[model samples]
Target: MGGLTTAAILSDLGRKVCVLEQHYTAGGFTHSYERAGYEWDVGVHYIGEVGAATRTRKMFDYLSNGQLEWAPMADEYDRFYVGDKVFNAVAGKDEFRNNLIRQFPNETQAIDLYMRLLDRTGDALSAFGMGRGMSKLQRFAMKPWTAWKLRGAFRRITYDVLSDLTDDQDLIATLCGQWGDMGMPPRRSPFMAHAMIARHYLYGGYYPVGGSWRMAETIIPKIQAAGGEVFTYAKVEKILVENGRVAGVEMKDGHRIRCDCIISSAGVDNTFSHLLPEDVAIKSGYRQRLTSVTPSMAHLGVYIGLKGTAEELGLPKTNFWIYPGNNYDKAVDAFMDNPDAPFPVVYISFPSAKDPDYENRHPGTATIEIVAPAPYERFEKWREETWGKRGDDYEALKEALGSRLMETLYDKLPHLRGKVDYYEVSTPLSTNWFGGYQRGELYGLEHSQQRLKQDWLRPKTTIPGLWLTGQDVLTAGVTGAMMAGLITTMSMVGARKMGPLLRRIYA
Candidate 1:
């Protein structure tokens, strides 16, 4: 999405852009796949803040030329199962607050305080994003003001900040239930990250009208109309650097495309550790800087196909977040320490239920996706093996994990146990095989407090003629990456030009 968004925007600006996607299909994580007459989106589950003509919706409209459409999820978009307790988040801001208040009447004061913090964090987030596109001089000049805006919430840990508001661990867990959206537990994540995600979904969640793949499908025409092309299976072997500047990219097939300027949405780790030359990475200090951040959590994906339609199967549009207990940090730590421990968090999404057009595409079939954190080390030994040909031992391990995830699904929706037609499990290795993350990272870099504090993780890089964007540049999710694209364009083209362009799109 980051790459496509940047290309589409630049294309609109009359700069023809070429998008090289190594995968057989484009859309990065937004891409969808088919198996046994059923389709499932890989990364995109549900997006928020697109129910109306908000900035996010406008950006989508502009990029897709109004071709892209959204289908609003249920008013109760998210359902959290914290152990034996059940909590939910409703659509409107007042409804969400009242729902929380109803759940914990004693925590009204804390809930109100949290809501105020979320409101205040909105401005801080805007400032943080704007600061990413600024030059060193601009950022330096604005440092005091930016720091003041970001001081308390942005600098503090999520758990610490929430704990300050209330001592109720269950309330804290309820507030932090969606921590998996950013791939960090409360203790490790910055409060700003939590607030940004919470505020983003204050309205509700929306699914693409057709499918997630429609995102790239719709945006591709805009790029093509402007004389640009999106090339799939175009694997880039390395980024050609000449005298500390980007020259072009060398394809895996020994073909090279020369361009002075380059914007890498491939991710910070991939750009520095894999694509760039060792000497260049060392010279640029990215080699040492790389140690400051770590890859985000890897995951196991359980894609299930059922015989009946979503309506027939009683699938709800609300996403289910299942937790073993309320101590998110402790649960994560235990699971990380021992693989045998119960999963810290398991996120289940009913794609067929969310997308109103699903039945038209795959008649009488429903798709369910279950995602849970998995350590890369568990599958590291087979990383060198081929994708589908990873030997019986690997297949057995995947089957075991897949069955366990199926039980988790059945535990919630018990009626569907015997109705599954087919299912497959994808390990982190599958992420590397398809998405090209070496460590099979679900999100690019971990959204830790320290990682979020890094000033160098922006669109404009110290390397001349080279820029960075994507989830690593901003936060995570489709919108975050799309916003990174906007920021990257604003950085590439001066504010003088981008200002009018923004007005044309958002106004």
Candidate 2:
């Protein structure tokens, strides 16, 4: 997202830019993998807050030059199966809430309040969503409490918010079905976090045409046309610093590329702990906040390739938010401790179901991804000097989890039992080593309302000519990272031009 968004904005502003990626492919997790005939998305199971008529859609349209296409998910895009009851999530804004109220008739008021809060979260972004330059005065005013944010963090986002709204436990769990997106559980994650994600998709989530990679691919050409370049497998060994200021980047092959600024869509932990100097001087409360706050959750994803058509094999359109039993936190705990534990929280999605052409291209091919929150400690025992190395134990752990996922898939889709052609599991170890994220946390720092990394993770940093961006500044997922990219560009240019730029792009 950073690579694409940065290239677009910078190229538009007439600044020569080059995006470096470690993977042979771009888009990081957004890119899809093809094994035999199956294509699946490693990230972006579904994107919310991107209605066709909304500002996000307009932003996407201008960014991609209308080259991209979005497919609206069908009725009941997602289904939640807790215990014996299955809650169908239909598309259409009004339809979504009405169905929820129908399912939990007695808790109508609670459902209404939940939806309203979700809206508030989206509205709240207006305060921060614009590039920082738009509100330099506000940012300056709030700088002293950089360790803290929004003043009353818990009041804005806490268990108390939801608890006060609804007494219906099952209803609440259903409301939080997409918790994996936030990475942290409800108890630890803030209500503001939940509201931003939830409300964004309330009009219903969307699936990109082609695949998630198309999102990256479409923007690349736009960036190139705007005079930028994207180089792949070009690993940056370290950030070059001159007198505590960012000078450029030194690649693994010993080549150096100089630049005026740097923006890392890479996870925060990866940026600070790996790319930058290990003992670099800590300038402000920013580094302190990073040290003090806990990182977000990691994930274990099982990607399966099936030998049969999704319809014949019984696949659903929306994702399946499956919990073995309703002991949400306990189930997550068991799975984190014991990968072999029975009945863990599983989120299942089939990319081909979203784009049948993918299946048309690969007849009788279906792809499914089953993911669960995992702990960095499970494989932290192997975090030694071999930082970027892949190990034997790593593959073994992946296979164990993969087999379990296959079992779960077969149970859910019996016809697909023997029809599965291939499968693989991705763990935190793989994420940290390959993706360069520290401790395997998907999003950067956890947003707990308290200890927000307001100073450090933003565009401006303690060192001169140095800055930070990506998942840390705005949170994870495509939109959040893109917003970070916008800020990084704004920091270089004038902040006042941000709103006008949007108007220009649309014009």
Candidate 3:
């Protein structure tokens, strides 16, 4: 998404950009796969702030040339089931607040205060993005103002900040129900990360009109219109450097694409640990700086196909987040320690129900996706094995995990117990095999307080002519990567040129 966004925007600005995707298909996590007449999106489940004419929506419009459209989900977009209790988040801001107040009338004060904090955190995020686009001298000059702007929730831990507002652990869990969105529990995540995700979905959730692949399908034309090309299965072996600058990239087949300016949306870990030369990484201090951050939790995926349509099978557009208990951090620790323990979090998304044009695409078919945290260590032994030809033991382990996830689904909707036609399970190794993450890290780097404080993870790196842009540069989610692409463009072009470009896009 980050690579596509950057290429699309630069192409719009009359600069041709070529995007090389390692995978057979483009769009990274936004891409979809089909099996047994059923298709499912890997990463994109739902998006927020696109139902209206907001900045997010405007950017999508400009990139897709108004070909992309959105279909709103149910008013109660997120339904949380924490240990037997049921809670949900509604569409409008007031409706969400009132629904929370109705459930826990005594915590009205805390709920209102939390809402105000979200508003403040939104402002802090703007300042944070502005700082990323600034040059070293500009950032140094505005350090005092930027520090002051982010002193509140941006610098604090999520659990610590929420603990100050309320003593009800259940309320905290309910507020942090969507923690899986950022792939972190409340205790370890930064409050800014929590607030940004919470505020983003406050408006509601929406899905692409046809499918998630429509995102890349619509934007690819913009890049091609400017005489650029997007090539898939073009795996890059190493980044070439000459005289302390980027020369080009060497492909796995021993071919080289010699371009002076190289923008890598791969990732920080891959760039520093594997792609760049050891000498260059050490001299640039990225090797030492990499130790300060860790990869986010890996996951297991269960994709199910049903014989009937979504409406015929009675699937809701709302997403379901199931938890064993309210203490999310403690639950995660217990599950990580013992695989037999209850799942820390189980998120089920109804993709067929969310997309209005699903019937047109797949006719009489429905698809469901279930995601849960899975430690990469459990699958590390299979690192040397092939993707589909791993072993019998690997297949058995995946079958066991898939069965467990299916039972959880049946527990909620018992009527569909025997309705599933085909299903498959994917482990962390699958992520590494396809997405190229060494540890199968879901959201790139963890969204911890310390990781968020790192100022060096910006567009412009110490290596001249080499740039960075992705979820690692900013936050996770498709919108986050898109915004990071926008900031990278601003940093590449001066503010004078970007001023007119921004007005032209957002106007």
1 versus 2: better TM-score goes to: 1
Score candidate 3 by TM-score against the native.
Answer: 0.99
Q: Residue-wise lDDT of candidate 3 within 463-491, one digit each (tens)? A: 99999998999999999999998998888
In candidate 2, list every pair of residues with a backbone clash: 49-200, 49-201, 76-89, 76-90, 157-191
Candidates 1 and 2: which is better by lDDT? 1
TM-score per prediction, in order, is: 0.99, 0.91, 0.99
Clash count for each candidate, listed in order shown: 0, 5, 0
lDDT per residue as tens, model 2, 399-450:
7777777777676667776777887787777677667777887776776666
Off by over 4 Å in 1: none
lDDT of 1 at 171: 91
Q: Report lDDT (CA) for all predictions.
A: 0.93, 0.72, 0.93
Q: For model 3, where is the 10-residue window of minimal lDDT?
A: 118-127
lDDT of 1 at 145: 91
Say which prediction, candidate 2 or candidate 3, comes out ahead on TM-score: 3
lDDT of 1 by residue, 1-507 (tens): 999999988898899999999999999999999999999999999899998888999999999889999999999999999999998899999999999999999999999999999889778988999999899999999999998999886789999999999999889998998999999999999998899899889999999998999999999998998999999999998999998899999999999999998889999999999998889989999878989999999999999999999999999999999999899999999999998799999999999999999999999999999999999999999999988999999999999999988999999999998999999999999999999898999999999888987888999888898989899999899999999999999999889988888999998
